[model samples]
Target: MKIVVAGATGSLGTQVVEAVRAAGHEPVSISRETGVDLISGVGLTEALRGASAIIDASATSSTSTKASIEFFTTVTRNLLAAERAAGVPHHVAISIIGAAKVNANYYAGKAAQEEILRAEPDGWSLLRTTQFHEFARQLVGHGKLGPFQGVPQMRSQPVAATEVAAELVAIASGDPRGIEPELAGPQEEKMSDLVRRYLAATGQRRPVIELSIPGAWGRGMRDGSLLPKAGTRRGRQTFDEWLATQSR
Candidate 1:
């Protein structure tokens, strides 16, 4: 099968591309970095020419709600339009476990994408996965106080991106089943504790403090809205196991 991996250079996108290739499929790498701007529809038609499946893992780092929503909605609309024109069989998206439930600006963008895909004519599959184990590293300097790095007051069942990538490839090769089962790590963990353990594992000296962010987004995080529910698939790599393998 011919597969198009949007955002092919991102953390999960890179792995998804490799996974597709390893499974004996032709993987087409697409991203702004690769000269394919998903938001503007530039190079979309050409990139999706012979694609049988498309995995949309593209994302922006923008925190602005309007900008994020525009970017996500535009990209999703363009991809679906191109897929319809190109006769693509499946549209697969990588989504967070509680994208719709959480009120984070980023989660709002994901939810918008999901809504767009749900209405599209093509066969669509939205795979909601838990936070990536590497999320700990991302949080290291994100939420900060006065000279102190702080973590968000949240819980997550973070799984490895590699494991999620493998599952995405498996889903891409199979028939679309609408929203698939959620994927999560072996155990639930506090976000702050995870980051602290991650720093310790890497021999870093940063103290990770926990902070309560105000809003529905923060409330959702604190109340377990980001966790995978029962009957979801779980990966084997624990945070400690993942931390142990990191060189830094």
Candidate 2:
């Protein structure tokens, strides 16, 4: 089977591409490096020419709500439109856990993507997962304010991106089943603590300050909203473990 992986150059997308190969399927990668502009719809139809399924693992780095929403919605619309023209059967999307409840800058965009996918009467699977173990690394200096860094007041159960990729590949291999069970890490850890520990492991001496965000988004972060719910799938690697490996 030929699987087209959108955002093939991203962190999770790269792993998804590898998982596709490991699963004994051909992966057609779509990214700027490969001449495909997801938002612009350039090279999309041709990319999906012979694909059995297309996994949208793409993401945007913009923190602006408008930009994030535009990027996700545009990309999703373009992919679905091209898939219809190319006769691609399955459209697999990766989303964040509690995206609907949390209208935070980035989560709002994810929720918008989910809304679009749910309306489409095609073969599509939406996988919602918590933050990845690498998320802490990504947020190390996220709120850097001179000598003290501000960590968001949140709790996260982060799974390994590798595990998420394998699960997504497995889902794309079979028929679409709508939304799948949420996937998360083995345990929950405070985001501030995780960032602090990460800094220490990397031998970077910086004071970590927890920022109390306001509004529903902040509530969602501080509360258990970001944590995985009952029956949510779990992964083995702990944040400490991922950090330890990084320090080595």
Report every candidate's CA lDDT. 0.87, 0.89
Worst 10-residue lDDT window for candidate 1 reads: 139-148
Alpha-carbon TM-score of each model against the true structure: 0.93, 0.94
Writing each residue's lDDT as its tens digit, candidate 1 over 1-248 gives 99999999987899898899899999999988889999788899999998889999898877666777888999888888899899998999988888788746778888888888788655999888899998888777465566667888998999998899988989999998888888999999999899889888887777777889788777888899999888789999998888888996
- Residue 209 in model 1: lDDT: 78
Model 2 residue 90 distance off true place after TM-score fit, in angstroms: 0.5
lDDT tens per residue, model 2, 14-121: 999999999999999989999999988888888999888999999988867799899999999999999989999999999989877887688889989999999987
